[model samples]
Target: MKKKIYNILSVCLFALLVSACYDDEGNYDYHEISTINTEGLEKSYTKTSYQDVLHLEPTVTATGGESDFEYLWTLNLTKGSGTTSNKIEIILDTIGTDRVLDFPVNIKQGFYDLTFRVTNKSNKLETYQVMSLSVVTKFSEGFYLLKDMGNSTDVDLHASDNSLVDNIFLKMDGEHMPDAPVSLGLDPGYCFVDETTAEYVITKALTVCTEKDVRISNIEDMSTIYTHSNMFLGGEAPEEKPYYVWRNAYGVGYISDKGAYFSTQASLWDLLGTGKFGFPAMVNDDEETKPNRNGVFASTCFYYLDELKGRFLFLDYNGSLHTYSDLDENNEEKPNKPNGITHHLKFFGKNYMDKKSTGYALFEDENTAGKHYIYQLVLGMDPFNPIEKVTEVATSSKLNGANLFAVNELTAKVMYFVNDNQLYMYDLVQNTEELLRPTDMATGEEITYISNRYWSGSDNADKNFDYLVFATRKDGKYKVYLYEILGGKPYGKPVRVLEGEGKVVKMHYVDPSMSMVSYSYFPNSF
Candidate 1:
């Protein structure tokens, strides 16, 4: 009886299906939507200057309802949104509505995601191609001017393109600096392979310092990474004022209260304090260990002359401090030397081209107090040996009142000095001097700063000696002048003159090496 009921139900279902097939009155049709195949779009576009046009012309192919289509080009910034690798797009601008783009890239210099979209108006179908774009500017590199505005200090950029960005700290940080600017430290990490551990290392960054505050800013984007309290490993800077801050191939170094401190090749990334600095560079200033007004740095160490002891001291790359002996065992001038003591030696960053422990040193006579002498220095490769050369320059009329000095890196023999309003070039080879003064002094203007710094990070080899840089102040107004060096001397007048609102304390050429990336400590991260 169950088998008979099951057969009856199956027959009823089959009859219903047959009846439905015969009663069908519907039509099925197929349509082809527009398709777009875009070509000539590179995977990425990078490193274009700000003044150039975005000349992008791509070959686009379409089919089906291609005749009726609309085009749109949009730029968006893709940002990571959570812990995952997923990204969220923030549309920056709708650049164009045409198939070809001849638009000027007027956006800020940075990385952006570009999207080209094409839609078939008839079918409402859309197709897109995305690309990565990187924008840069010529204005990113050039001279940096530290301007002293009476009560405060700030930075300005005289860009490579001859454009000036005034008050860069305020423009980028959205406010004034924590304190007045003190000095600029640029370390373009010169990567080296450590022989002992067979490890490669590069710790690079730019340090902008003030009297009481230190700010570490990223050179890549000119962004503030760590400032003031966060920059110090101790959480707070030393109560004593910092006289100098500098970065070189080895590490970041600074001088505070006559003592120099170094942070070995440590970076801001990976962890804190690795790039942070601590401890006063080794100094036994019996009389308060008073270091000189300024000091110089080697590739592996920073050097200073103690005003109290009148000896040379060095802080190595490992954060260890040492003093190179400048005396004989007898405590008297060595037979091979005269006035062998470094008591009156003052440093002016003279080791612009030394790959070892050698360069020029300036000496002052204790007898003729205000006078100075230029000497050759080779403190020896090791601490045990003292082999050096000193230039015993007599106190002459030309050398008198020579307060400012700038060594010419090209010749290594030309020294530019200023006396009152007069500028003189002293040739060390011939021991002769030439007066470079304008000779038409109306109001007395005093010269303030002069330097011939070596730009090790620059591809231009002669960057150090190519210009004669100096500053002058009179009646509260300041002028920073740069003269092109021809032969071994500057032009009759400055090729470029930058007027400052207050005193122009220092000027430096910002080079490519100063910019440090997020250099990974892990070898695999490279």
Candidate 2:
């Protein structure tokens, strides 16, 4: 009986082993597998900025499996391109459950074609699917400006045209560079030091590229000196000089570390003191000697007024603007300040105006009247009569915080700060005030102050003009928004024209003739 029991137990063990084997084997009716599901073999991929990697996701399914199944994947580009076999593979029993396949490896940037195939235990083969994808190369070109504190450098390039031009560099010569460089009305053309030496200088080019024959002293002197700052023809004779007497032609306006300030008429190379205005009144102080009497009023803003001659403006930091008139009449040696020069104003705030100028000025009532006013100034007017104090258009309680105001010199339309986020426009001719609330513009729910710098295209050269540009912070980044000046005011939804990671430090329309724009960017950090 014991022997019989042992034999029975052995038989039972064999049966159990066979049962386990059956369970492990995939169960599918081969006869029923007449159709294979290639739909399960769908594959897709995504491309990234990374140059080398290729990512793939593939899904596979089969109608029936009589035995173990296997999958083979291959990648191919165009014809004649080599093929990668089994770049990815799976055994239906063990790894087949995974529908997504990830292939992480470096691949060239180009078009690629891929295919996947599968085979079952019966040796029946099937082409799963074919896919095509593209890998693009990444490259972009444009202009950029770099600023370090008061020192600023700009690089402009015509990438598509393959033309490289307009590179400007302004380095503060003193302790630190100011935020703005006022236009001293110095000519950026040929600067003459004395009647004999002539130096060709372009503002954009001088900032970066070095000229073969030019000397720094030559440029510096031309930039600072007025009388000798102009170019004389080959046959022109030098005027008899007590050279000192010639200096009276050009007046020195303001000087900063970026460069000396002289009338714009002075050639690019004239020396500073040689001009008519001489150097700005020198300040007498113990802490630090004021370089020029202009005194270091404020360092990071600019203001400009466009007049009949051209555009007259001053950089807040430099206290001067680029002037062509200074170049025509004034000789290099006798640099003369641009005529009709007026007082400079500086506004302070984080998003405060980076620059100011144009038909108006910000003034505070002295009577403790708690009223701030915008005054239209006559360009190049006698400083004493700088402002006829036109009309009391807009009033602001926070005069100290107001950084900028703009006037449509053509329309005589004034836009000023009623509050941080609220802007009001007064038509000088209409004598009507209109409120421009942030909520009205689809710039998000929160109302924020629009940028102080405002621009209207020449289309508005006529009273019915309609396009405008201004800076505003939205979605966490500062962007220049383009708005249509409908009916003489900022109206309608604003479209983003330019965007950058950094804040726009300053923006100047490249005059009305050209569609180009000159803007400065200050990085987030200092």
- Give me the candidate number with maximum lDDT: 1
Model 2, range 126-223, lDDT digits (tens) per residue? 54666664443221122222212223323222222333333222222323222332211111122223435442222211111111111112222112
Model 1 C-alpha lDDT per residue in residues 184-211, reported as the tens digit of each score: 7655442223336654433234566677
lDDT of each prediction vs. the true structure?
0.59, 0.34
**Candidate 2: lDDT over CA atoms?**
0.34
Q: Highest TM-score, which number?
A: 1
